[model samples]
Target: MTSSTPSSPLLPAFGVGTFRLKDQVAIDSVRNALDLGYRAIDTAQIYGNEAAVGQAIADSGVPRGELFITTKVWTEHLAGDKLIPSLKDSLTKLRTDHVDLTLIHWPSPGGAVPVAEFMGALAEARALGLTRQIGVSNFNIALLREAIAAVGAGAIATHQIELHPYLQNHAVAEFARSQGIHTTSYMTLAYGKVLADPVVQAIAQAHGATPAQVALAWALQLGYAVIPSSTQRDHLASNLKARQLRLSDTDLAQIAALDRGERLVNPEGLAPAWD
Candidate 1:
């Protein structure tokens, strides 16, 4: 959000999302992202492309410290015994000693394990220097409260979540802001659906930016860091330009009016919304 926030200091306002890209494609995307001035890279073990991401980061020759690298530990491996190993696997695949940030992929709502367990484990990993910062993803306010209480001092460095104008997560976002925790916004593009929205297209025409950039600009303006994924050269190039698209107050209000509570990436079996 502000320049003083945790997420703000670690990366630029926008970056690249590499969730589904894999093998040579993923590797190529990472390299291309670096070349395009994308200082942040979001990846996760569940994505199955850590090695490809790692290879590209290594070859890009961009100093490791300059690039903000992120990876996540899947919910399946959050058990005390499996946590470290999972993080190790991530490190190995990422070709880095430590990641700028690491997140819990999901809370595994219907699963038996407690949130305290993994959040505690994530704090421990942070203490052990496996990651510069640690947090959770796909967790609503209740889960976030649990995560915050569980981790205590290492209290979530950030909360990666599915946030778009449609699914305005105001309460949790407000809570995060109050506590000085940051949010990592995934699926900010509505998984390509924004490309077809008439309102977005109209706004794009007015701003002379693609719908993709308009969507990203809206999210970034609201203070959540964004990661939009793209495989094509032109899409990636245009997506990065979102950082430069500044919307006026009226434009922002139009986007705010566009919210219809449409959530595109809800994890099945999670608790109800944090109203």
Candidate 2:
């Protein structure tokens, strides 16, 4: 079913997440999401789905400005020369002149180019008009501070990180809030684990929502943008209601108490000291 939301410069806080989807699958999934009223689509270099995501965008008939597309440069490609080229390649794949936002996938330490250099290249890309907004993903409090110190807040916009009821992330969330930095909560549903949690289910029953909606609502209430992925049309359709589900103060606290700092995809070899 197609859907849309009231206009808010702040993103919908609910979007499509394409992480493990492959070529043809990504394309089909994206088209489905678009037809279903999802204006925001998230992709990354590591996801191996840019080409498919691009294809879907190309055929969706959605105005470029209307759709908020986000793509990222992999940690391995954070070098000076690689930065622009990688972005160019992503643009080529997405079939767009520019993306809504381009992010540094990881703050790899001692890889090749310094974070400052990568951030500089990102700023240059923004100036070049290849990307409207530039930001970072998988960044922690220290890296957030480093990026702020190096590039300033005006350049780096949001920090995309793993946040869910199971991983409260209050520290980073509060810090970003104070810095006027918005957060995009990837894995907002805890990769489907939240779907099975008795607590989440109970909360969902109380609000007449799915468990995913409850978890997503928890993060949204905490002021973090959420992107919950679902290959199933039913789940995707139900997830949109997450934005409308407003949990109470006590409910929010109960969810926050579930934090265990669990991580889903670190790949420390790709980013040493990733924790």
Taking the tens digit of each residue's C-alpha lDDT, what string does model 2 give over 42-152?
Answer: 999889999899999889899998989899998777887789899999999899999988989888755466778888889889989999888898777877877888789
Q: Deviation in angstroms for 81 in model 1?
A: 1.5
Off by over 4 Å in 2: 1-10, 272-275
How does residue 233 of candidate 1 score in lDDT?
Answer: 77
Clashes of 1: 0
Cα lDDT listed for each candidate: 0.82, 0.81
Distance from true position, residue 240, model 1, in Å? 1.3
- Which pairs, if any, clash in model 1? none
RMSD of each: 2.4, 4.1
* Candidate 1 off by > 4 Å: 1-7, 270-275
Global lDDT for candidate 1? 0.82
